[model samples]
Structures are given as C-alpha cells and as structure tokens.
Target: MSLINSLLLLFIAILISYLLVQLMQWSNLFDKWLDQISKKEDPSFGNDTEGLLEVVETLPQFTVSDISGQLIGIQELIDNKKTLLIFLNEECEFCGSNFEHFSQLINNYKGKKNIQVLFQSNQKETARNFYDVYDGKFSVHLYKKEVISEVGINFFPAYLIVDPTHSIDLITHNPIQVAHSLNFD
Candidate 1:
C-alpha cells in the first residue's frame, strides 16, 4: 500500500507539471520567454562576420542597371559619397517589414546620406515591382550577385554602409543594426 501511494504521488506531480507547461504554451508565455532569451543572445552569433571579412572588406566597383534599364557602375552610383547599400528581397517577409522603416530613414537622410536600394540582377521583375510602389526619392538599382557576394551577402535583407573611400564600414543582418549604424536609433 505504501509503494502504491508513492507511485500515485509521483504520477500526480508529473501530471501537474505537464499541465502547467501546456498552460504556459497555450497562453504564449513560453514563446515570450524564448523570445526574451533569443534577444539577449549576441547579434554576431547568428551573423557570419567571418564570411564578410573573408570576402571583400571594401566596396567593389560593379555595374548594374537603374529602373530605366540603363547600365550604371557602382562608382558612378556612389560618386564619391558615403552610401548605405540595402539589399532587399521581394519575397522575404522580413524585407517587406523592414522596407517601411528603411523608407522613413532614407527620407529623413535623403541628401545627407547616399542611400541605394539594390536588387539581384536576376530579380528585375521583382525590382520593377518594388520601384513602382516605392515613393522614396532614393535611387533604386539592380546589382549582380557577384557584387553582393564580394560584400559577403549570405542572406536576404542584407545591409552595408560604405564610406566615401569605398571601405565597407558596416555589415549587418537586421533593420535594428541598420538604424544603429545610421545613428537613427
């Protein structure tokens, strides 16, 4: 009888623990806790800083076309100005969210900072779609994959700030990083 009572007690504890966990999950408390944990993690842990370092540390001169289908070189686009290069994917959910924040940033810094929106050369249709709806005064250009690869672009919604000397001063994975880099935060 004593052994049966001990087993019953253990079962109850386990059942209570299981239900508590389920309640937390059902209320999304577990997810919020996980999000807090993830937010505390080092940003670089998810970013391949090594990959960008291994690739071109400086912005390279590469040619891409503008909205009118006219070919333009990177040097010409930047034209000795410090530029913020934003590489966005039309299909990416994150990019769609970031676009609004970025548009506001670009509008605020219009002439003060040379901000350029880049799309993969292959994504002409997607680029055109973005261009059509985009009301920002910033120039939108298409970039070759090689150009971005040189800058160590491994993911969508990539960002880099190149100084007037063509040095890549900042490389980042998220919109917060962009805001921080631009000192808009």
Candidate 2:
C-alpha cells in the first residue's frame, strides 16, 4: 500500500479505538480496569453506581434562604441531626418522583425537627413553585443555575445524605435506598 494510504488507515484505526474507549467508560465498565489493578481481589457485589447519586465529595457549609425567607445554614441544619439535600429542576420528571419520595420521608420523620429537607434549584421561579407544591414540608432554597452547574452535578435530580456532624454518608440515585440508608424514622 502507498505510505499516504497506510497513514490514513492508521488514523482511522486510532479514532475507532478512542471512540470505543469512551463508549466503555460511558457504560461504566470500570470493572475491566479494576480487574487489571487487582487480580487477587474479587469485585465487590455492592458495586452499584446507583448509590453514587446521593454523594457529595466534600459537604460544603453555606447559608441559603428558605422559601419561607428564613436564613438556614448547612451546619446549623445538621448541627444535631441528618439532612437530606435534594437538587431539583422544575421541568425534570425525576424531580417530581423525588418530591414524592421527599414527602414520604418527611412523613416518616414527622415532627422530628432534626431532619431538614433542603432544596437547591436552577431557577428561582421554578424553585419557588416547587416550594409551593411541598407547602412548608421542606426547607426549600433557591440558587442560580450556574451555581449548581458549577458543582458538577450533571444529573437532574441528585440526592446527598449528610450526617449529623455535617459529613457526607452516601450519594445514591435510588430515592428509596436513600431513605432506607438514612433510616428516616
């Protein structure tokens, strides 16, 4: 084959390989890479990525005004109790399900002032409307879209569980699992 043709074929092969690598990563086939790292160790059965949806690398302490116009800080909320931080966008269907789950959790934790349901929203109007829907069940907060985007939460409805000491416990996509993990009672 000509040198130019050979070079072209090489470039196409490289491109295809790169795309396949990305696809594998996107599909979360990290097991193959993990296996290479450890041959003796068997993969953990609890290797589900769904649990990661509720996690925050470092639980940040910040003050945000609730829908009732009350200034609530993260530390203060979790000073002596757990907190459920829900990131919601009004248009997201997942968020609607999350809201219902939040209500169930609230019912479970009824009259327990320790558990605070905090909200972070992309749009103030949508946030306000969401607050209206919940109707004081949760301490909803509104934030700028860029703020949430900056936090690197690509998912629409992200849930984070913060312990009593204001430390992250788990991040999971399953709201039911989140409620169970937190032991909302």
Candidate 3:
C-alpha cells in the first residue's frame, strides 16, 4: 500500500475507533441498572456487541512464516478452532499507545486451548523480543511486507477473529471493543 492509502486506512481506523467509543459511552449506556426494592437484577439490563462487528468477507488463502521460519497456513490454523490474528509493529505509534490494552487482551486469551492467538509483526529483529512484553503468552510470526497486504491488512494494532468456517468474523483496531466483537457466547 502507498503512504497515502496507508494514512487513509489509519485515519479511518482512528475515526471508527473514536465513533465506537462515543457510541459505547452514549448517555451512560454502560451504566448498571438494578431493582432497588426487589434486590434483583434487571432482566433486560445486559450489554452485548449485537451489531458492532459486521460479517467480514473472509481472508484470502495465504501462508505466512513465523519467527522460527515455520510456514503456517491460515486455513490450517482455523481448523477445528478459532484463530485471533493480531497485526502489530514495534515502531507504530498507535500500536505503542495501545500497548496496555493489547497486553490486557493478550492476557485475557492466554493459554486458551480452544482458540489460537497468532501475532504477526514485520519487525524481524525484534520479533521474539517484541512478544517478550507479553511473556511469550502466544505465538508470534514474522512476515514479509507483502504478506500483510496479502492478508488484507493496511494498519497496525488490528485484530481478526477467524472461525473454523474459513471466515473472518471480526476485524477491529480498538482493543476495548475486542471482547465485544469476540462473542463466543
């Protein structure tokens, strides 16, 4: 992708993230409601990501090499399980700003056998060290510049949830909205 297109995608990502945050915080939307007299919870007072994540057209067939030079196919990774593909770069300013949220997200899904978390970074030299921040809680892959574009990624700090059906379920840049998007419930 050219610099202009990349900048455009980054702008769009930031805008979408901002709009979602505004929507989430729209008029105490996340506030809790309780029955004062009955001392019971409100039946219809629950929050969910009912419409935040739209259906992704799915990723193309592509195989990427990890830091250890292992070729992992996207289809194979999603077989009989879900794969959370994280695209990040060590030098990305936006990525650096969201490190805390990313850390929390990694921690949330760490050691989850039912699903697989794969981290993709372009920093070859910092591949293993970059993940050390997360205590190597998940697998990190190093891919060529074209590989990210081949996978339809234009920006850093993006997340994709791929299901066993060979489709990308969710793609978002906001870490706070990840849980809402990953509705395994």
lDDT (Cα atoms) of all candidates against the true structure: 0.70, 0.59, 0.59
- For 46-128, candidate 2 gives per-residue lDDT tens digits of 21443233234567656666665677666766676776777777655456766687568656643454434434543666667
RMSD (Cα, Å) for all candidates, in order, is 10.3, 11.0, 14.6
Report lDDT (Cα) of residue 145, candidate 1.
72
Sort by TM-score, best first.
1, 3, 2
TM-scores, in order shown?
0.66, 0.58, 0.59
- Mind giving the per-residue lDDT tens digits that candidate 3 earns over 67-161? 77788876776675776777777755456556567666546653463333344445665667766765765677765566566666555566677
Clash count, predicted structure 1: 0
Candidate 3 lowest-lDDT run of ten: 33-42
Model 2: pairs clashing at backbone N, Cα or C within 3 Å: 51-171, 51-172, 52-171, 53-172, 54-171, 54-172, 55-171
Where is model 3 more than 4 Å wrong at Cα? 1-56, 105-122
> Model 2 TM-score?
0.58
> What is the descending lDDT order?
1, 3, 2
